[model samples]
Target chain A: MADDIKPRLRVPTTAKKGEVIEVKTLITHPMENGQRKDAAGNVISRQIVNALKVTYNDKPVVNVKLDTAVAANPFMSFFVKVEESGTLKFTWTDDDKNSWTAESKIEVA
Target chain B: MNTLLTRRTALAAIASVIATRSALATPEQAKEWLAAQAKGTPTEGKITLKAPEIAENGNAVPITVSVESEMTEKSYVKAIYIAADGNPNPPVATYEFTPLAGKAEVQLRVRLAQTEKLIVVAEMNDGTLYTASREIKVTIGGCGG
Candidate 1:
């Protein structure tokens, strides 16, 4: 498993019913593209967070496929409509099959 | 005077074509990439891509893509693709959306190696594709910087 992998999310604590809100996410990752060499001139193994999926209230909101070109600490911001109070789930999967998840809740008033 | 004006207009048209061809990915390359991703034929329009014209740091260049859509059960943006012409891996990211998602807009940060044209293609639920592109200049390298 990757070390020190952490998922971060920014979501509003409250929202109006049926309102569109912005959500931002970030994850700490090295995102090794397999093109780098060490001091001894050996190619580092490729390890990247290749996919990210987000769900709101158990319904899919967004699914992202990332490539080697993505930089370290992947960050994404997107919009979602809130119909009721629920939790937003975020999952990030890497090339090594390691995955991390985080969740946030919002209240609709 | 009329003949001179016509000749100048023709010259301008040819110059513009050359400029675009040099800056953008070859049609064949774009087609092959799109086809590999299983995206059907993409027509140009409806996709709006916003990125910095000049990025001081290539490590985290912000980008946003929005598609015209009505986010209904019958109609919505199915997916959105972001690609770079000069990156080692041209395809940067793909965002898939459903009607339940409500909107067809996304913003993310990407690493660009150098000055290159960024392409955004949005696939509609109806299987139609809309595309847009922009050029971004990077002064610092993402990997090393």
Candidate 2:
């Protein structure tokens, strides 16, 4: 019953024209790599987010590949130059073929 | 009596290896992984990797990587790769960027099995390679806790 996975994002609602801004995103996941054992000494199966994609105004911005070396509850921040008002979409895909998404809009003057 | 003693010694050796096991990736694994991506030996400049000298926890060690890039259609950082020599896997993450990004910088947290060297490599659009690294001392292992 690992249905508590969720995506959260922090993006500024507005920006000056031609201003560079930062976008932060986080997701809740165990990110288990199958190396750790419990009190009973049983190996935990590996489960982690495999990739993350970000698009701005329907154009690709960044593509990230996540591996077992990434910690649990992944958090990432990147820089973007805003030229006009548009929407930013973030998609996170996991090992189980599950994809989660979060979006935000920015108004540029 | 000699046979029994030898068996006991063998078991102890195995146990010691397990207890001291830090990471699955060896030092060479990290190099091989980097070599596979880079066309030649990458020079050590253009990218700045910031990491704690002593990380209290190995599960989430905060790191920030910034590279000098104009982020224009002509010249920009095409991709950045991160890996640790002392992790279960050498390849940690790869970030591909486009001209839309104003800069080539990012911040995130990573898992490290123990005290080891963390490496970051950057590939420019013109096929130039740049890299930087830092050593982090983790008090607790990445998976132990």
Candidate 3:
């Protein structure tokens, strides 16, 4: 199993009401595609994060379903419209059913 | 007529193989995938796919998929699927969006086994479909190798 998993985000802490902001996220993972062979020529099993879900103030914003073709240390960026001050939560799930969560707060004036 | 078309395609394939000096994925499988993934006949507008014309590295090719929409509760982009024809498995990702997303745009990185075509199909809240694609040339394969 891959270790040292980490999640990173770049979100503006403040925004005007009804403003559209970009949310950039990056997670550390090997994203093993199961296509590689070790020194012994044995096939490596695939291990990858399969999904990412984002919710704003408990309302769903977006959910991305990942596949083996996604590169390692998956990175994504998307836009969100903030109307109020609330928390934006992110969840990433892997093939092993392991999940990591992160959150960012954006204050809207 | 069919035979003539087949021969012409075969000739083109040979020419392409010689130019690249490697085997590549034909557009057939990718076209079939696009057709199958779409809920219905997808139109040619409302969506845009951006990628480098020539990706220096295939392991991490950046791409952006954008769909035109007002992003309201009644009308918005519901889902988007991306696939690369040259990969062992074409599917790259599927993104689902709600009105809260405000804009139906996403940037992602994908692995491409070789030079191939990337296709994207989007489904809207109203059940309409939009499609777009791009051809990316890869200098090195991104698969396990």
Candidate 4:
């Protein structure tokens, strides 16, 4: 019932060759520590997005570890030098062993 | 005798009220929280994330990210994600962009709770995830407060 784990990406739908571009990505998650107590004093189970992998045109680009302290809806921004048209792949994993993926296309004219 | 009984009743009522509220948590409270904070689209390989080796302040620290792409219509950079490890909430911020955003780069201030690795994920126009991280040391407590 929790479909909130969807991946959100901020990408330019278009671009030009030799032009630098900015991109960002985020995911919906609670990053529960398994330490918080419910009103009934029961400890809440831990739930967090733990791993991330990024690829360009199916090539390895970046990989990261999502730790326990990351805030909810983890966000990141950066630049990429585009030489040719290609695809970007972003994947995030949660503690429940669920993984979500998103992609964007660049034209590089 | 009546005064003592009335005081006891008031205390019991207050306790019961607190207990009830705690038990009545909405089924989707956590999910709702996540949705409200969600940002950007996820991409895989068009960007780079750069962070500091050490963070002096747990409350506020600086971070930076860069990407490799051409800004033309055919090829360009897209978005970036910044997340701090060990923070109470973690998902820091998601930055959106367009091809007009020349030089895919962003610098920001963030809050960290303790010493841990910070992750930065970038998404290009074609849908990919590029990532990087650095270990930052937090001297003061930020998350517990």
Candidate 5:
């Protein structure tokens, strides 16, 4: 794991069968647009998260496409309905061909 | 006699011209942006967008959107759209959510080209529309100043 890259998420370990849970995620990564110029006037080259995918218990939940407009250390918060106890998987991919994945488990009450 | 007539006409024409110019300038180019957003008829009380008054950094400004709902199978927030008035491309981001997703809320960091009003529009499952806007002042050339 890249020390600079941290995935922050909110997931309750336990939930009711039909309970609805809110999930928030923020990743600590420098989303370089690659269009910016350095002190030497050279293009920084885009290093942004191109895509983010989230799955719950091997079931696809949310898929996102990130762009240059996404700021550094991107933060995204949303909701998920918990039908059963399972694992939530989050993955983010960058332009430099790097993929970061994190998983959190939830238990149904 | 002709000189007097010319002078009077000149004065009247200049006055009328100045009056028209002032009338046109009264509506700043910025205010027109807001009117242009609600060009169509939308249902009432559908969306609420909340943002800070001043952003220290133009690069990363936090934005949040919330829709009033129960997140039920029959009623929920369908989609949320965000736009910045003065940015080069106003459409900042678009999010789509389903009933399986309980509450309709999204918090994210966005880049503002400059200080401008950020608008958020939420489309509910029932086809109603609610909108809210907030102005964000972005300090130029700074890191979360």
Candidate 6:
């Protein structure tokens, strides 16, 4: 569960100060919902990315509470105000108690 | 004959309990859930919900919610709720935002059990509620897949 998890992010390279910019993220995960049966007819235990948090310049921008209804690869897009040059940090936590983090930087001119 | 009747009554009771547990929320139930979350706040305009009218695969349906807001210190969107009336879990996801979030917009992927109405509710900083809803037709089921 820990080896294959990967976090991806996209943000503008540069933006005018106080400008609104879009941030997109996608994570490669199986997001097993725990309801499916394997070849042996045993129910698979659920393992999903249940939460995601994004911050810009150390300020929290978006916090999402996900559920089993989310698909295999979770993708999220939101907007943020670039007040200064800083790094955007993204974190994903799964049901297995594993957490992954990724970061991207943006220049506010 | 008396013993048979008693056994039948017990079976009926168990069946009713199982039905209640597995049944999905009806339209009214979903509405009540959203209303309770609103907490007497009036639902007005300023919410835009984008979802495909027809989803080829219910396993991964893309949805976006955007609200008209300046997102300044004085006023901004505090939270957003996504709900689907037909799914086993009516409340899909809830998002929280701060003033640093320039716009009140969020995009995510969700699963639909069948054809149902998806609802988006936005809570403003001043305690106002804005809402938008759309119906999505799912060709293939996604929840159990």
Q: CAPRI verdict on model 4?
A: incorrect
Runs in model 4 deviating more than 4 A are B1-145
In candidate 2, which residue ranges exceed 4 Å CA deviation? B1-15, B18-25
**At residue A43, what lDDT does model 2 achieve?**
84
Off by over 4 Å in 1: B1-31, B143-145
Per-model chain B TM-scores are: 0.76, 0.85, 0.78, 0.64, 0.66, 0.79
| CAPRI-style docking class of model 2 based on DockQ | medium
lDDT, candidate 4, residue A55? 69
Candidates sorted by TM-score, best first: 2, 3, 6, 1, 5, 4
TM-score of each: 0.84, 0.91, 0.88, 0.49, 0.72, 0.86
lDDT of 1 by residue, B1-145 (tens): 9999999999999999667545543434544576676457778898888889999998889888888888888888988877887665577888899776777888888887778778888888888888888999999856441
Best by DockQ: 3
lDDT of 1 by residue, A7-96 (tens): 989999899998889998999998887767888888888889999999999899899999876778998888888999999999999997
Query: In model 5, what is the error at residue A66, expressed in angstroms?
Result: 3.2
Tens digits of per-residue lDDT, candidate 3, B1-145, equal: 9999999999999998666534445466666766676668888888889899999889999999999889998898999988888777778898999999999999999999888889899999888998888889999889864
DockQ head-to-head 4 vs 6, winner: 6
Question: lDDT per residue, candidate 6, A3-109, as tens digits?
Answer: 77788888889999989999999999988877678888898888889899989877899899887778888999999898899999999998877889999989877
lDDT of 5 by residue, A1-109 (tens): 3568888887788999978787888898888765567888887766778677778887666566666556888889777789988998999888877888888999997
Comparing to the true complex, what docking class would candidate 5 get? acceptable
Give the winner by TM-score: 2
Model 3 C-alpha lDDT per residue in residues A8-73, reported as the tens digit of each score: 999999999999899999999999998889999999998999999999999999999999889999
lDDT of 5 by residue, B1-145 (tens): 9999999999999999667544432223333433353343455465667677888777878777888887766987766666666554455566666676777877788887666777766667776667777878887622121
lDDT of 3 at A19: 90
User: What is candidate 4's lDDT per residue for A72-91, written digit by digit as tens?
Assistant: 56665555556678988888
**Compared with the true structure, what per-residue lDDT tens digits does model 6 show for residues B11-115?**
999998667545854566667777876665657689988899999999999988899998988999988888888876676777899989899998889988788
lDDT of 5 at B132: 75
